[model samples]
Target: MLGGKTPSEFMKLPIEERENILRGYLVTDDDVQIEEGDDFGLFNKEIATGSLLQQEYFMGEDEAGKQLVKEARQIYYRENTFSVRSHWLCEFICDTLADGKPIPIESLVQRIIVRVDVEDIYDMDDDMVDFMPEGEKEKSWVVRDLRQLLEFTNAEFIRIEVSGRGALDGSDPQTQEKIKEISGIVKTLIEQFGEKLTIRKLTQLNDGQSIFHDLRSWLMLE
Candidate 1:
């Protein structure tokens, strides 16, 4: 018995059931001891850890869970490990936007694209799942529209664009205040992540004295 059932009883279960139980109980070595000149053992340990992290990420249920697991995987791969931090920033932005109205899924996707460094494409040989169709064979989908990109790439930099279509001028005190609040959030993220993340603001407004301009300047000052 592993948990409650006896070993004999568990062995009698279906293959899938047994597999699930084994996965739940599986534990990989964390502090492997290596003898002198045993470089092969270290290499094997790295490969094993990488595989385990991949499994963890794929088994995750939500974007936040998957992002954390992916961050661990990135650390294992010796790449940047700031994807989870970036995801949190996106979440903060989304929450702020939601304070006014419910953010549409499409709008949320666009916001993520503007704020994250997504791996837009991957080769068939890549060990990723759920790829979109390309021309001939199916390839990894472009990260431009998918929220899952946050889980698959090192999205440490955020670039937000404010359109001049709406009333972004300081004449609208309410709108100006909202922009200031948003700017504050960005500033906080910059201070927290420091060099790990770069935040930028782009605006279509031509007015140098507009709120959008001020927001961009504030970000630059940081």
Candidate 2:
């Protein structure tokens, strides 16, 4: 409520003006709370920089603008939606025929978010699944197993993402030294799967500009 404007209203202003307001909004109050799940929370940087606004055509003001937002929302899922939060959940949604139980992802409101953030111990109970075209039932198999895990289901490009939090925490496998191991996982998935499989660590800080793009330039992804 700084300057008597709601977050939504603040977004409508030009980025030059919006950035000025946000500077005060963020620093003026110690107790100021970020609106989680709101456009403001998810895309603060992109919105403040006008990157996201430019993409959505200033928040879908026209019919043509509406299509951009529509397509963005369809293809762009926030980071936490997939491997960042639930790496294992991805195996269930594979386009390939697997023996696992079916996931009830029928409803638009329903998303299958399974959190498997346990410390990786070398115990017998450890559940290590890989997408490296291995022969483990819990792991992803190439082609005949999870067809789209590698080859494109329909889209021209693919991205598979994971978190470095585990490795950073000095877990059994993801020791602090192995912090870059997650990169290997990303590489393995893309290398083993379709050549187009590319993963980038974009945000929601959640629905930010980098979360969705029209493939204007691959260099922009980095």
Candidate 3:
């Protein structure tokens, strides 16, 4: 139109003329309006090559913006699935009695520590145990030689808000009761073996509060 030519012919002009054509397209000599999200209509090859070549026109405004929106959504939900999962393990430990026989002190300690470590895999928050990932092997419990693993879990939970969050607290007091249960196991072991059930390095992170928070942090970091 700017060069006394049709829209198709005008497209044959150089890049500078292409800009002029776009300017003419935007202005309406009479009355014209275009709404967003409406089809732009089939474009001629030359016009498409020249006008649509610009990033904003051809790609639209939302290409990169949509990716960022998706990423934010992903970030928002990254830890939720795991959070729902870690609780089942806690329930299992709390609800199940160890074959009606007392859980050995070292064994009980080992189970609790391993459980705490497992919680770290799903969540980043202080309270919350993440569900295990699909087909992943759970860490072994150090029931036999409970020195290093127990201490490591104990220390890690402490650093990750053991007092604020861990298996030591719950609404039903099951976690605490479990501790006493474990202590009893230790006590019995002490009587049977004629040796002190002294855990010199690792101290349990229970403080009479819900420890889901502690477990969540541990698993999330993991």
Candidate of highest TM-score:
2
User: Which residues of candidate 3, in runs, are more than 4 Å off?
Assistant: 1-62, 74-173, 177-222
Question: Residue 25, candidate 3: how far off, in angstroms?
Answer: 36
**How do these models rank on TM-score, best leading?**
2, 1, 3
Ranking by lDDT: 1, 2, 3
Q: Write one digit per residue (lDDT tens) for candidate 1, span 128-163.
A: 443434532323222222233333233343344333
**Candidate 2 residue 158 C-alpha distance from true site, Å:** 1.9
Highest lDDT model number:
1
Cα lDDT of candidate 1 equals 0.35
Query: What TM-score would each prediction reach against the true structure?
Result: 0.24, 0.26, 0.16
Q: Residues 155-213, candidate 3: write the lDDT tens digits.
A: 21211111223233221343333333234333333344332122211224447333233
Tens digits of per-residue lDDT, candidate 2, 80-194, equal 1222233333443431111132422212111122222223321222253433236543322221222324322333334433223332223334322222333334445545544
* lDDT measured at residue 107 in model 3 versus the true structure, 0 to 100: 23
What are the runs in model 2 whose C-alpha is more than 4 Å off? 1-85, 88-134, 137-148, 151-153, 163-185, 192-195, 202-222
1 versus 3: better TM-score goes to: 1
